[model samples]
Target: MVAALDVGGLGMDAQVSITARPEPISLDPRRTAVVVIDMQNDFGSRGGMFDGAGLDVAPIAALVQPISRVLETARRAGLFVVYTRQEHNSDLSDAGNEDSPHRIKHRRMNIGATVEAPSGIRSQILVRNTWNTAIVAELEPRQGDVVVSKHRYSAFFETSFDTILRAKRINTLIFTGATTSICVESTVRDATLPLHCT
Candidate 1:
């Protein structure tokens, strides 16, 4: 499909014509991967991150079943399945100071406050090895699945995501997960860029 996107800016009118494939493309099982992003308990489950933050998790929760179905179908079709979980070190040492402002915001909103897990482990939201950092049970990775733990919104950032994709000879990526505007979209945008995927 061809789209004419209006690129209007600074008192000027401009349009960019972009062509996109109209029909569904066939995938080669060996060269394609299904990337499931940030469907961790923190983002989708009750008493999890979103809940603790006081955000309505209904919409995010709605994605689990459908994504589970996709994962099943992808597995049956012999496609590589990669699950990305957003997590930080227990001490958050990798989070750096630039995100302190956001951390402050989370604190102000009572989102990232420390809490005790059902297992009686105390940790902030999305900290590594915590309940909130684990993938939802229904969509957990199987024996052959690939699990990538990421600290940033983009799965490819400072991670072995690209290396894995290349090593697996994956030329195409199918992405599905929560927070369309944040983690999911961030990964998609990065994947669409030419990033030496070979």
Candidate 2:
């Protein structure tokens, strides 16, 4: 379905129709942004959080190339690109204090435990500025792309993500990343809501 917006700015129109489930969606680069969510080492690489917990990283690892291609295409089309990292504060303050459900869940998973990354660096799982929280080398955010660090599964929750999109006058989003049923799905659902952007 084509839902064209005014998208003022001479010579900025570059619309394309992408065949998708449910219907064919029209994309106008001027009004759209591509959100790459939680494609971090802790979730997609060996010796990181998911791998340390015995979860298979193969599936997540396989996505790097495809997502890279998508990002390249988006850039060429002049679409705004945003990358999100799921991470917590180094002191664990923002991870929820004193047996909160958030902290409990993380504890169960040993979320902050130190683990040796494939790069031979020992880093705390999902902690900001650590190897585990960094986006994989293959999909690093290029210059001119925005990066946001989110503590929760949904990037939009208590984050500047929505505000950033609104400031860019973005009305359409293309989401791609790890854990389709979790972080990715959560962000996509949140994006559907109307925000009273100034």
Candidate 3:
């Protein structure tokens, strides 16, 4: 059997057992969320940003089915679902101004350049509302899933992601998606910090 999230809950106070390092933990399903980060075409699909830059995306593509299964299980357990997309304005204003690290990084990657995806759609890489930033078909957000558009690797940066989680009372987060070392890790770090506390 696939090692999906072991979520078992019933009443409002139901909790799921999780095997963690150092010690085991239990969490309420109602207060948990599955956060899917940057599973966009630009990173996982052929002829998208990663492919256009000559990077191998097969491993990223391979994750879709497993993630889909986990998502389905989460939904069945009534866990909240949230998706984060790395996107910027068409004019790149949100990416950052000249000499800024964000703009410099994007420029190094040639982000926003027009490219023809394998799907035959012409789209600018990582631009908001474009095909490149759309979640892969296999894991598209269903009704009631929150889609958070982020301009940086960390989803909480200048975005409503944290607010949405707080509003939904989501205290536990189960993350899945591409670039585990970069975007995924960044979001995790931000999520654990008490940045909002004054």
User: Can you rank all candidates by lDDT, best first?
Assistant: 3, 2, 1
Model 2 — TM-score against the truth?
0.89
lDDT of 2 by residue, 38-152 (tens): 9999889887788888889999999999888888777766779999999998788888876787788778668877777777877898899999999999999999999999998
Q: What TM-score number comes out for model 3?
A: 0.92
Q: lDDT tens string, model 1, 95-195?
A: 65646754554444344457877677775787878788889899989999999999878999999999999899888787889888999999998988788
Whole-model lDDT values for every prediction: 0.76, 0.83, 0.85
Candidate 2 vs candidate 3: the lDDT winner is 3
Residue runs of model 3 more than 4 Å from their true location after superposition: 1-9, 196-198
| Tens digits of per-residue lDDT for model 3, 68-187 | 998888888888999999999988888888889888877856788887766777889989898999999889999999999999999999999878887887888888997899999999
| Candidate 2 segments whose C-alpha is farther than 4 A from its true place | 1-11, 196-198
Of the candidates numbered 1 and 2, which has the greater lDDT value? 2
TM-score of 1: 0.82
Q: Supply the global lDDT for candidate 3.
A: 0.85
